[model samples]
Target: MAKCDACGTTILFGGKRMGDQRYCNDTCAGQGVLLNRVRQIPDGDVVAFANQVHSGNCPKCSGQGPVDVRDSYQVWSAILFTRWKSTPHILCRRCGVKAQAGDLAISAVAGWWGFPWGLLMTPVQVGRNIWSMAVAHNPNQPSDALLRQARLILAQRSLQDGRSQG
Candidate 1:
């Protein structure tokens, strides 16, 4: 059985095949293509690309100084099930701060009810969000994650162009 190139899930039935990679769905296929393209980009060029992306308007609010931020939260239910969620956003400092604050509140309120993992992970996730907020001292500078996101965006655009032409 072929495994999905993007998520490593086993392909139990028919799947999309691109070159040597197989994907279970269109989303996985798109992700796989973007990952492949990102791998091909040189590390030296990523920062430059990120700077270019930072200069553009935020996808969320059309504001300047857009940066890519991912905030995670945990939720526990029935003492046995734990859910960890990470949300990604491309926004200016004001919007990112608001989103992070909301996720942090949710995690703090509802993330510590399960057995061992919920207890352990809730603090970690909360701390990570706090640290992210504290360290964002400059709104104008693009973060490392923003750099990676920029690379992915470039790859996606290239892939789209290739698809349109082919």
Candidate 2:
């Protein structure tokens, strides 16, 4: 039996056979994949907009905010999915806004829609619409096209709002 070179544990599953294989189980292998995927997405910034129940521009919405959420198994699954999906959200300690892995996934799609200059608009726009639905006690089914439109509109409005503020 081939041994896991790092931990010296006996590897139960057959090694990739391509030569040097290290991890003993799928867990370690998956960890490597997760790390790589995270590196592909931008870090340290998040998208946010007005929520239906809370549109008063509270401290969380004032002058931008920093936020982060757990990218666990369930959340990641929601984000990678292509159609309408919902998942629990995590909030930033500083900002009261909530977002899930799926939320981040939508943002990635909107942000990189184009080359040279990816629009910073998809996730926030979709989030706003979803929030509205949440407040109205309606179940908002997220779609690819609708999400795209929401992102575009949010990007434009955000730019306009910024310019007006300047």
Candidate 3:
């Protein structure tokens, strides 16, 4: 068994491989990632760049092993609906339009159970929040009516896909 160079944890099967495979899992892997992203430190001559990462806890479900969104319809369905990352703008494939990011929350909201609930939450609700945030952030992007229609389209698409497959 290979031991992680950083944490000394035994590298399990499927853990990412690097230089004989350090770090037992992605959390540890992130430490190295964060370290690398910060180029300079100290001496009063340093600025930290923003670290962009998918918000919320690990989305993978573990049972019998680690099951990812790709493995099950339910998981994949959630992934299809969930926003992977926040961007200042996104390219819309439908109309070939570029959209400015709205006032969407930068972090995923947690439910009463202390778990990431945004993915499990309704896409219409989430999408509405995103659309509202978007229009509020930049009125130049699209009208609220147009954004609402887009959100409904996305939510409906997800529902249709889920029903068709699951």
Candidate 4:
């Protein structure tokens, strides 16, 4: 058995292979690619790149004080299967609040149809969205996860620019 490169899950059988790295699924493969890109950036440069992103405008609304927010929503069908999704967004406080409101509404409406998992996850996701909204109320600085994502974005852009010039 081989351990997944992105997430350390024991792979019992066939798995997606990218070069020498093996991943359990497509999502893991995509994450592995991103991890590789992030690794290309030097450790000393991460803080500088994050600072640059912090000073820049929000990618969505072009507003200041952009912060990272992740909201989870759940949906279940036929008392058998449950689907949950967590989406991350980098937006100003106003935009983040709007997005969280949508997630909250959706989770409240569609998150309680299935079995034990749906019952268990619905309230949790709803509370999580509420918490995210409360945190977004005071957008002072970018969160650490936001800073890391910013560094990754800047590093990817720089690599693309270098490739284009060469």
Total clashing residue pairs per candidate? 0, 1, 4, 0
All models: lDDT?
0.77, 0.38, 0.34, 0.75
* Candidate 1 local lDDT, 1-166, one digit each (tens): 7899899999999999999989999999988878999888776677788777677777788876655555544454448777777776777777877777887888788888877777877888788778766766355677777777877877777788889999
Clashing pairs in 4: none
Tell me each candidate's TM-score.
0.71, 0.21, 0.22, 0.75
**Tens digit of lDDT per residue, candidate 4, span 41-148?**
776677666655556777788887544544545444348677777787766677767877898888788888878878888898888888877754334555677667
Candidate 3 clash total? 4
Consecutive 10-residue window with the lowest summed lDDT within model 3? 66-75
Q: After superposition, how far is residue 150 of candidate 2 from its true place, in Å?
A: 23
Residues 52-152, model 3: lDDT tens digits = 11111222221121111110011112323443332222222211112212222222332112224445543434464455333322312333333333344
Q: Please say which candidate is ahead in TM-score: 1 or 2.
A: 1
Off by over 4 Å in 2: 1-20, 36-64, 69-90, 94-166
Which of the numbered candidates is closest to the native, going by highest TM-score? Answer: 4
lDDT, candidate 4, at 9: 100
Ranking by TM-score: 4, 1, 3, 2
lDDT of 2 by residue, 16-111 (tens): 322344666666554434433334433211122223112222244453322222121111113333233343222232232344334545555544
